[model samples]
Target: MLHYIENSKTQVGKELVLMDIGAEYHGYTADVTRTVPASGKFSPEQRVIYDLVYRAQEAGIAACKANNDFWAPHKAAAEVINKGLTALGIIKNETDKHPYFPHGTSHYLGLDVHDRGTYGPLKAGTVITVEPGIYIPEGSPCDRKWWGIAVRIEDDILITANGPENLSAKAPRKAEEIEKLMIEESAFNQLELPKLD
Candidate 1:
């Protein structure tokens, strides 16, 4: 559910679509990810999870400052997610080994999509990504309403002496902002492509 099959004949419907995209300019590549509701509106339950993930991403981004260890972001994000999931009863307690958040929350970015680094303390001028997510697939242990819900929000952060700077700040992450943006016409709507047989 985190990604779509290439050219799959399926519709997004009212479900959420997660796009993990990367762009290259000159020699460096930038990676970004965003999840949006297909209906341009989020169900109440979906909004809860999305908002929780958003808060977790914020915590992670805050840990992206210089002098922090490379793992600081993931630790901060995981702490928020663990507590949020506990409050939602998705996990029995904060210490429960839940499957909801199963990945690291940050990584280096530069020439390579996943740029190489020492994985040591963060330093000024370092560019990285802070992504936090919660995935509840069908038939999960929790209530049926949370089933098939997956949300991920990623932002590129630059480690600085002052603090972290969001390079992708222009991209909308708020539910209201996304809903507003979705109301606009997409330039791709007019494109026509030949069918491959």
Candidate 2:
């Protein structure tokens, strides 16, 4: 994926686009993507809502435990986001038509981004991402206050007998956490850079 991003720069746009494909040894494949701030630092407003989305993602992952239904994570994540947005003044009411979160909470994740599977009393083996997003496009109602901004957090998880296992735990989703990691990593790289011989 890194090689593709680096070499195929001409094929991509300035905005970050989450695009990746995965294959399992057991003949399963998965693909997912979430656009991020190319600069690696989200604006203040973006961070505020992004954190809520991350929290929702966490809630969804936590709901993927054994005996839970496939829809459990979706419901959990959506509820979390809705609650957070309500508190943040993004939504006037629970059923209000606000653009705060315009996407589904979760989806079937396997060979396809929206994989097909029985979404029922969850079995021991299920994988999905609880991605919630907020897109306030220009000239839109929500855009009046927060325009040209979008935030989303996606994580891959596998249901287990004990609980959910995060497959994409390496990715940082927290606002402060991500910023700190980026700064520390960048400093480390700079310190390791050799002076021009």
- Itemize residue pairs with steric clashes in candidate 1: none
Ten residues in sequence with the least summed lDDT for candidate 1: 1-10
Q: What count of clashes does model 2 give?
A: 0
User: Using Cα atoms with residue i matched to residue i, what is each candidate's TM-score against the true structure?
Assistant: 0.93, 0.73
lDDT of each: 0.91, 0.66
Per-residue lDDT of candidate 1, residues 153-178 (tens digit): 98999999999999999999888899
Candidate 2, TM-score vs. the true structure?
Answer: 0.73
lDDT accuracy of residue 131 in candidate 1 = 93
Which residue ranges in model 2 land beyond 4 Å of their true spot? 1-26, 32-35, 181-197
Per-candidate alpha-carbon RMSD to the true structure: 2.7, 5.8
Worst 10 residues of 2 by lDDT: 11-20
